[model samples]
Each structure stands twice: as C-alpha cells, then as structure tokens.
Target: MSTQTSLALWAPRLLSVLRIVAALIFMAHGTQKLLGFPPGSGGGPAAMSLPWIAGVIEIVTGVLLTIGLFTRPAAFIASGTMAAAYWMAHAPRDFFPVNNGGDAAILYCFVFLYLVAAGPGPWSVDAKRR
Candidate 1:
C-alpha cells in the first residue's frame, strides 16, 4: 500500500492511542490534586475550591476520555478546563506559556480540542458502541 493509504488506515488507531495517553496524564494531575500522590505534589488535602473542583473534573473526564466513552463531551470539557486553568492560574503570572508555566495547560487545551474534533477513533468504546 502507498504511504498515504497506510497512514489513513492507522490514523484512527493512533488517535485512540493519543486519547488514552492524554487521559492518563490528565488523570495523574487529578490524582496529584485530590489524592495527593507522590508526596509533596502540591494540592494539600482537597479543599472545596476551584482546584478541588478541577481535580474532580479532570478525574471524571479523564476516565471517560481514556475509556473512549463519551469521548467528545469529555474532551470538550477537558479542553475548556485547561483553558480556564491557563488563564486563571498561569496567564496572570506571565504572558507567554513558557514564561508563565502554562505550557502544559495550553498544550492540553489544544490537544483536547483536537480530540473533540477527532472523536474517539478506532479501538475506543465510542467506536464499539457505534
């Protein structure tokens, strides 16, 4: 098969992989915030506030995205959350993502947006449900 055809065939699977990996990483952030894993990973004891709410969102949406269940909505919510996180937490610190330490948030925002557009792709629960 030609390169283009091969790429097209594998792209869906690749997207699913991306979704799974991104969700896993996002979940780690939730774990750090809510569960306080890895010891001193900030987010001291899960108070009833924005960070805690963010952690809950991350965990729930991350799981949904990872499993490819309700992928679009999960990704959309995650994207919005990341955007909010960047603007509220990082943008005030500095203008650029690199300077403000919002690089991850920016990247997550875009990636989740892409996932929202792309859907769950092959090997996802969404695909199976369809």
Candidate 2:
C-alpha cells in the first residue's frame, strides 16, 4: 500500500489507542483523588467537596471513555471537567499552565475536545454498536 493509504488505515487504530491510554491516565487521577491509591493527592474516601465531585466525574467519565461507550458525550464531559479544574484549581494560582501546574488539565481538555469531535474510532464500543 502507499504511505498515505497506510496512514489512513492506521489512523483510527491510533485514535483508539490514544483514547485507551488517556482514559487510563485520567482514571488514575480519579483513583488518587478518591481512593488514595498510588500514594498521592492526600485522598481518603473524600467528602462532598470540589475535589470529591471532580474525582467522581473523573472516575465515571474515565470508565465510559475507556470502554468507548457514549464516547462523544463522555469526552465532552471530561473536557468540561478539565476546563473547570483548570479554572478553579490552577488558574487562580497563576495565569499560565506552566506557572500554575495546570498543564495536564489543559492538555486533557484539548485532547478530550478532540475526542469529542473525532468520536471513538473503529475499535470503540460506539463503533461496534453502530
């Protein structure tokens, strides 16, 4: 096959891989916030607060995104969560992500936004169901 054809064929698979990896990483953040696993975030069965709420959203959306179920909506929600996180937690600390430690939040926001526009690709449950 031509190089262009090869890239075209592989693109969807690459998107699926990206979705899986990003969801797993995002889920880890939730685990840290809610379960205290991986030993960070000072988490422990969190109370009903901003962090707790964000953690819940993260976990739920992460799972949905990981399995490619309701991917567009999940990604859209995740993107919104990240936007809120950046504004609420990081923006107040500093103007730029690098200064405020909000790089991950910003990155996740854009990536999830991309996923929202792109859908879950061929390997997703969304694709299978269709």
In terms of TM-score, which candidate is strongest? Answer: 2
Q: Per-model C-alpha lDDT, please?
A: 0.91, 0.92
> Which portions of model 2 miss their true places by more than 4 Å?
none
Looking at model 1, residue 17 earns an lDDT score of 93
lDDT of 2 by residue, 82-124 (tens): 9999999999998988999999999999999999999998888
lDDT of 1 by residue, 1-130 (tens): 9999999999888999999999999988888888876455444544778989998999999899999999999999999999999999999998888999999999999999999998988878889988
| Collision count for each candidate, in order | 0, 0
**Position 42, candidate 2: lDDT:** 44
Model 1 misplacement above 4 A: 43-46
Question: How does candidate 1 score on lDDT?
Answer: 0.91
The RMSD (Cα, Å) of candidate 2 is 1.2
Worst-scoring 10-residue span by lDDT in model 2:
37-46
Mind sharing the TM-score for model 2? 0.94
For candidate 2, the clash count comes to 0
